[model samples]
Target: MTATSDGTPKVAIILGTRPEIIKCAPLIKACDRRGVDCLLIHTGQHYSEDLDQVFFDQLELPTPDYNLEVGSRSHGEQTGRMLEGIENLLEAHTPDIVLVQGDTNSVLAGALAGAKSNIDVGHVEAGLRSFDREMPEETNRVVTDHVSDYLFAPTEETKRYLERESVPGEIVVTGNTIVDSLYEYRDLAAEKSDVLNELNVAEDDFYLLTAHRAENVDTRDSFDRLLEGVSRFAAQTDREVVYPIHPRAQSRLDEFGLAVPEEIRTIEPLDFLDFLRLESAAALVFTDSGGVQEETCILGTPCVTLRYSTERPETAYVGANCLAGLDPDDIVEAGTMMLGKCADWDVPFGDGRAAERILDVLAVGAEPDAAEVPT
Candidate 1:
């Protein structure tokens, strides 16, 4: 790892999942352009090379300088291990600042470790709230934002959320780096990927489905309901339902004795580029993932969120998304409604310059120390 120097400070970029890899690509490039020495660190929360390698290759992201290999575990265990690993790394590298994106446990771990080390921490996609504390992501975001020295919110709503909390960090509404990445790579995705052809799915010929939340997968009833919903939708619409299954979801499906239907194709998880192509061509998208919710809105694809709520409610408010709680009937109804509707809604996320704005915020000096206050 590179050390901080007088000319240019060393910046540590931390990521653990495919979403993080995609969202951080633009910011990594932005830092490179500014002559910042970037150290990419992978926490290995999601450890499949098949699932993660494509993103690095597709995004042209640098191989991580270090990989903690902190594989699957309970939420507490994973977070605890990541915290220890990241703190040790921060101590060795002595980066001027740490950059973490989104609301993963990895984000929280990186932020806390950096803050404890007295290194400034910058959080991209900060200040998002679903107002549901049961979700681990909500807790992760709350803790990460509190410790963050720089908070890069994607929307004005997010900035307001931070302001309401009286967060001391500099808050800049940088649009969304995901949008920047999507628009930057969409053309390339279209040209390079054979996902459409392989799936026998022509433009607007199929509905996309992705459900991988632990709440939904950890329960047999919930898993069965999700499968039933997809089966019903496929039978009724005669349109293909393509699900690029997360490994955990696939395991749950088997455990529940649920079979993915013939019309409902269950494929391995796709890389970032392939997934983007599928998202752009789909008639409608059904998912529980925050990243998919944001991307579907940007692609102008109507979405039916399989969860009761989403942190990215801006998509729902803009008519690009509808929350259909994990019920077979609701899923079918929402998918039907979306299939018949015209996709003309505007994207609520900003135009693709989020990375530039985020880096600009990070370039500013750190927040004031509480001890510096005068009596």
Candidate 2:
């Protein structure tokens, strides 16, 4: 890895999704503390200014050095555009390492472009696989991990996944950065956010809902099923299903001419802190969001994943989450079952120091050396 004038490695952190921004926040702050030369690049995968810019402002992250603004497109078009844009930026900036997180088209393109540029790529939250080749993110994570030079696995389980696949990169089991963000921002949310008051809901009285996975949202039938489930559950239980609708999901709903039932309260996307407060206080949550799976686990809140499969099996294994695809009956059943269970459980993520450990690996050129967990 090439070092800058002051000897610290130059890292270009790339992310395109709102969840990616939240996950990368701790690492960005860590770089600031170490005086490492870092550049944040937003791929503009989620183009809504409210969703994208609000996170940067809320989390106090430096504005992205570059935003491809490649907005949503077919997988081929999006990846191709990102490949071109990221390649240009990497060549011009000449960063020592390109860091990307999670399974997104942006992550895949960034890793590919960086490796092609002969710059080592560090993939945070790497080695996750749902074993379902049909899922776009499964392919993204698989491709990204294979090409990356530094594979920062969130858990030993994911490390095993990479090992089973025989990936070439050095695997360092740094706990999920989501745990760090949750711990840091949960308190901050309580201090700065009045989300609950604005929504007119008290702690533990409502079920926080989020559903924006392409599989569930893009498919007309699946999207309808999710709404039906939420509506049914809310009508039966007399509890509000607080849904902070994603822009993409809303667009799909409009296209399908589907309406969220009066029982399911819909609102705009919440900033990172506000969302954290909402998640922490919810009696249970229903969503297909991967980050939420990890966050709810750390918060000791129950979650009912609205997808067929999940990359984060650790949450299910710890009994903090239940998977109930797009089937309305199944969704209601899983939500009811989870709500009936206890909230307190062992958090399998980390001690909120993942960012520090990640920087430790980068400091030594991502060579596996020492840690509480390394797989």
Candidate 3:
């Protein structure tokens, strides 16, 4: 493992997607203060400079020391490429421990590479389970959690899930890092952006829509149903639906000859700050994202999840989120209900000091006993 001039251990932070970058930012800064040499590595899974470069600048995260340039590809192809690239980087850098966050393929690849190299792997935002075998992300989470030496769960529920599964690691309940990052960046965005003024969005004038799941986008029927539902809903209501079109979703929209309705404003994927401003000022949020569910819950903004199930069910448990599958009618009904609902909901996620708790656990240097593998 690489050592500092005075022989301190080096910590390598691995990130690839936009979410990973944001979630890892606070921890990276924390490591910096402790005199630990931090090396940031980007797997380049989502390699858009516009979507990525601005986040690093906004979040004040250090630019990656290594970029693998793995970019967008088939699931197997991307994972294979990242695994090989990460293994090579581990050989070269030899960090004391490799840190990966969330349930991304990049995280699984990093963990597998670290385990194969006999280096310690620390997983942040770990022990989350959707219990749905159909979703690839669920598989990734399970694999990464099993391989990881440290499992940093975001809630007691997540920790309990790990305990039931007999996971061989120290599962610490550190709360959600996204909440910490969200509150920090939200304050900054409110001060810097005149987003509310520019958009002419009052506290509850419009609704935000974000849908880019593979299950929803892979089929023409599902995509059409979503568009039709939004179109019908917008026609019935006076409010506008602002959709920040994902690149993959945009391509599908064009290929399917689907027009973005006049009432639906299709904009590019927003940076963290702009997104926070939009979500905060919206009357309601409709998404298929787990992160968005938690974010909207913390903001006390009602949300309609466009998927059948969510990894973050705490939002629903707290009466803040509604699961409105891909059916257009259900989507509209859920959105309408959220719009009229009172904004007094409890934050199921803990108070936003998850990063500090996670670092505290890591600092203790408590390693789990290695378990024997069943043949």
**Which candidate number would show the highest lDDT if scored against the true structure?**
2
Clashes of each: 0, 0, 0
Q: Candidate 2: minimum summed lDDT over ten consecutive residues — where?
A: 366-375
Q: Candidate 3 at 223: error in angstroms?
A: 1.0
Error of 2 at 247 (Å): 1.4
Measured with C-alpha atoms, the lDDT of residue 105 in candidate 1 is 90
lDDT of 3 by residue, 196-265 (tens): 6766777778888888998888788998887777767777888788899999999998888877777788
Which clashing pairs does model 2 show?
A: none
| Candidate 2: residue 36 lDDT (0-100) | 81
- Per-model TM against the reference: 0.94, 0.95, 0.93
lDDT of 1 by residue, 64-155 (tens): 88999999999999999999999999898888889999999999999999999999999999999999899999999999999998888888
**Candidate 2: lDDT of 340?**
54
lDDT of 2 by residue, 274-294 (tens): 899999889889989888899
